[model samples]
Target: MTEPKNLALRENKVPEPTASFWTIKVLATTVGETAADLISSRLHLGTQLTTVVMVALFLVVFVVQFRSRRYVPGLYWLTVVLISVVGTLITDNLTDGLGVPLAVSTGVFAVALMATFAIWYATERTLSIHDIVTRRRETFYWLAVLFTFALGTAAGDLLAEQLNLGYLASAGIFAAAIVIVAVAHFVFRLGAIAAFWIAYVLTRPLGASFGDLLAQPTSDGGAGLGTIVTSVVFLAAILTLVIYLTIARSRRAVPAKDRQTGIEEPAGV
Candidate 1:
């Protein structure tokens, strides 16, 4: 069904945090982990150079995302995928290039993320992604997303590598953590916004650990699929889902008033 005409003018810039959103987000996060390893190792670009290239791509996509008045599934997902890579690399740089401890990186990112949310809530009076309509709110949203990724990376690596939990075990732990967050939200009546951000942060580590479990060598307790194969498989999955979401969105009618005002209302919201 088409959205009500009156509601079209207040379209949010982000997608609803539905099952599909989380599915694609986890897939994109996996791609971010495997693809970064593929580029840095298989392509011989090194982590620093790979980070530079991905950040540039992320900025370009961010421009496209910011210019769009409403959530375009393809554009929004593309931004997510790129930012995922950039966030992973940021943590990698801190841990590897600068010799920062995983615990330190994790703590720093956690603090940064908390600060971003505090400022965002203080300024906008809400931390709900559903309220991201204005540019300022969208900016805060993306910044928060970046920190989630960085923090997730550091925490995941600390568990899987530094602490020797192994990738598969790490994935299991994170997956269980997500389930606990869900139970808290649905069963214990935790706030929707709180549950969402918690789950979002947890998914990053879960996805990354799963990627490593697939991409690392068998000697390392992984499946030995290698980064290239893992990256390709997850990326193809992400692309298929994105294409489906884009078509599903396009089939919805655009509100005429919104069209006249050069604004697009998100379909299937």
Candidate 2:
């Protein structure tokens, strides 16, 4: 069945937030946490060097992402994966390298994220990801992404270490929060942008706690899966999903035009 042209143009132009999107996001965030550990702890590169490497890789991926005319799932997911790792390292640095407490890091990142949103809204007058076509909006998007990851790391550690909740419990708490956000959005007419950012921030800790639960030693309340194994498994899953998305894109028609802007829109426009 053909979708209404207007609905196709206005509603479905941007990639729909489907099961696959969430799957890939969770896997990417898990990989982000584990991959950082793989580089810093397993390889003994130290946090500083690992952060440098991850940030450099993130830049390369971001360049590719920004250069793409439309949202290619593989490119978009790859950028997310890299940014997750880099963002984790940023918080880890403040906590480990500089000896800052998790509470302090969390508060700092929260403030920074709020500031980013405030400036973004003031300059663009809209915080909608659905309208992210301009370079300025893209910049704000990435900055917010970075802060979300950092804040998630700090918040997750605070729960796991400071509160003694353990990884499994922390993951459960975050998962519950995500559900509440979904309910608020769908049942209460919550704003789309607010719901999306709330969910996005929560996914970080959900993924981070899950990663810790899988990768930490059995004595540490984990299953002793190890960072390398966990990272590889999630990365493989992400790659498979990206490949499927790429092939699917080729089979679809040119995405419809946006009604509001009267422009050819990308899927998930």
**Candidate 1 lDDT over residue span 1-269, tens digit each:** 34344434357899899888999999999988988888888999999999999999999999988878788888999999999999999999998999999999999999999999999999888999988877778888999999999999999999999999999899999999999999999999999999999999999999999999999999999999999889889989888988998877765545432645666656743
- For TM-score, the strongest prediction is 1
Show how many residue pairs clash in every candidate, following the order shown. Answer: 0, 8
| Residue 209 lDDT (model 1) | 99
List lDDT for all candidates, in order: 0.90, 0.87
Deviating ranges (above 4 Å) for candidate 2: 1-14, 254-269
How many angstroms is residue 67 displaced in model 2 relative to the true structure, after the best TM-score fit? 2.0
What is the TM-score (0 to 1) of candidate 2?
0.88
Q: In model 1, which residue pairs have backbone atoms overlapping below 3 Å?
A: none
**Candidate 2 collision pairs:** 13-267, 13-268, 13-269, 14-267, 14-268, 14-269, 15-267, 15-268
For candidate 2, write residues 231-260 as lDDT tens digits: 999999999998998887865644485545
TM-scores for every predicted model: 0.90, 0.88
Q: Which ten residues in a row have the lowest lDDT in candidate 1?
A: 1-10
